[model samples]
Target: MSDEQIDLLFHAAVELQQRGMWEQALTQQREAEGLLRGQPSGARRDERLAALLYGTGGSLNALGRHAESAGVLEESLARYTELGAAPTLIADVRMRRAVALAATGRGASAVIEADAAVRTHLDVGRPSDLARVLQLNADVLADHGDPDLAVASADRCLRILLQPGRPGAADARYLFLAARRASDLHAAAGRPDPALAAAEIAWTSGREQGFAMPSDGLRMVVRLRESGDLRTADRFLKELRGLVPDADPASYPTPEPSVTLAQAMAATGATGVPALDPRDAEAPFVPSQRSAAPFLATAHATALSAVCLSALPEDVPHGVRLGLEAHYLFAYASEAQDSDLRYRFVTHGALWARVLLALTLALRPGDPALADDLTGWARAVVARLPPTTAEAVEIIAAWIPFLDAQDA
Candidate 1:
């Protein structure tokens, strides 16, 4: 109950949180809060309370209690606003609150909060702050269905971050985010060059920052495919698979089978060029084999697979076709989860591969029914995909007719 005891508890809570013991951390945080509440009111009371609320809210968010986390963040935001803290502090609280709101399905409210945070950062007139604001704005714009604006915001952020003397971690993060937005925008605009360039920048920056998300690698492969660099894309896919293994069959949120199917197809066209061993690369983050849940593991694996498949040769072998079919069956047999659905729908890596394969078969100068099968699969998957995934799927689907015409 003493001040010393409270400090000790707070430090312990932080350590626990860092160790991935969310529940224990939350318990310790709550204990610390209770100790603080029992003390008399004073000048530092509000500050102490704000810290406690912020920590509690952050822990709750990590534990997937979005609604509760939002409540705590809302309280923290109110207190930070009353204190008239520096723009940086206020912006941080607002950003956290916006994330919580988004997690709870309050998309419109989240965007408003994020926009306000961006405005506050801009008002502060710091290049770093401005870069952060632009990145946040990019995310909000992407959510709002304005890919062009999102890409522009990210580009602006990246320009600032790339300037000399900026913080390395912050610059890397902004550049990575910008690359992602640019890639998506280029793909949507049907421009392969810009997308490939953006993807390469993002992948290189992310690797340098020790951030090895599956999405980063997948984006690179996708852009390479779009640019007709199948050989490089295929090599990249093999490296990704080695980084993240396939998920177990009994996991709750399994990835779509289509991803593995696509990878199998792509591998067939690999030039067998010896790639630089990832272990030898001076990457900031070395990819590890931590046993994360089925959802994350599967989704990451699928993303890599999808990109690989998308980069396959036009005339793939029958053996590869058989392997793809088997992988597809495996994906289907896996339990359907949100991660799987999102990967399938939003990334559309699998759909792209299937469509490409169908197109290849149909336009073979003597083949038929390729369009029908592709259309049928696209329709079925499109109906089940979320809005984020819908746009990518639609774009790939639109290419089907052109492929058919080529055959005719």
Candidate 2:
């Protein structure tokens, strides 16, 4: 491919990445990389190849393929080092690699990489780059079990992001993510007022920018309740529930054993669907089913089954059967992190699945099969979660009851 063709491919890949279609973005990046590899070795060609590798690493990281992301990033770093690339360029990749490392449970190495990136950005004196690095560093520190230091990092990043005339002040994603980080850190430090204030920024910026999740709304409600604003909390809770329908909207009238967990969750939000924001749009080819109605129907049936099961005693055979069915469905629904929607859904759903699965196993601890399955799922949840948010803390703690039962 010619230089112009390569540039076009690179730009297209970047646009796809920005739109949260990381799988397609990765494909474009790899295609460009292959074309560049066919050319003879030169400084320019190598640099182009390195840029492509960096893009590949970023897409992989976004898709939750953290181990692969870290490896690709290492290659990108080596090439940049050989070319004597700019400090900013090197720091950018270092920051992204730190996140990938942190996600994969290499907290110590992640911390080192994050600190180095932060120092480079600080010396370079670019507020936007520095703020971005600090946000990632805060997450790495928090995951590394240094909440106080993480709080400091988050506070600094928020200051940079919120500054009136700063370079990153107007960036929607930067403002929302930084505010959310600061909110979590402040809550952990027992400073409820600051936490609530910061959460307000996160809620407003996230919703307006179309990047907010169901968890974000939940966080706001929790914070409001903590601050003794019960009326406001109740109002927000009502608004949230309003987004979900009270009845099943699917065409199916009966429940099937094959209903996957993703369909169930989609059913929960069948009514009052949110607008499809371009920035949050995933790859078009992701789900085989185009609509949420069928998912909602399956979810409704599953929920009814759970209600019936709840009325039965813990040791009842029918209850056990129902629980196992739900567990298997959840397992079957687990998808690769091919797009942003899947990534977010899995991140939140996996935690709930782990806890529920553990509870079921607790009732039948002698079932070695269920016990082992829960154990593996719990470990995966811990490795993948950032452990920064209050919601994460609470959900992680939910495993304790199951653990206690197992020990008994």
Candidate with maximal lDDT:
2
Candidate 2: which pairs clash? Answer: 267-296
Tens digits of lDDT, candidate 2, 1-408: 388888999999999998899999998998888889989999999999888998999999999999999999999999998999998899888889989887886644565567667767877857877777777777776654235446567667767777787533346677677678767766655567877887898888888878787767777777787789989988887887687433221221211122222332243332221222111213111111122333432343245245324533543444443343343233323321223323554444544444455344554444454444455455555456565676666666666565556557
Off by over 4 Å in 2: 166-170, 244-408
Model 2 lDDT vs. the true structure? 0.62
Scored by CA lDDT, what does every candidate get?
Answer: 0.58, 0.62
Per-residue lDDT tens digits for candidate 1, residues 147-247, read: 44455566667667877876466456777887777677656656688778877888888888876477777777777877898999888777876885642
TM-score quality measure for candidate 2: 0.58
Off by over 4 Å in 1: 17-21, 170-174, 234-408
Q: RMSD for each model, in Å, please?
A: 18.8, 18.8
Clashes of 1: 4
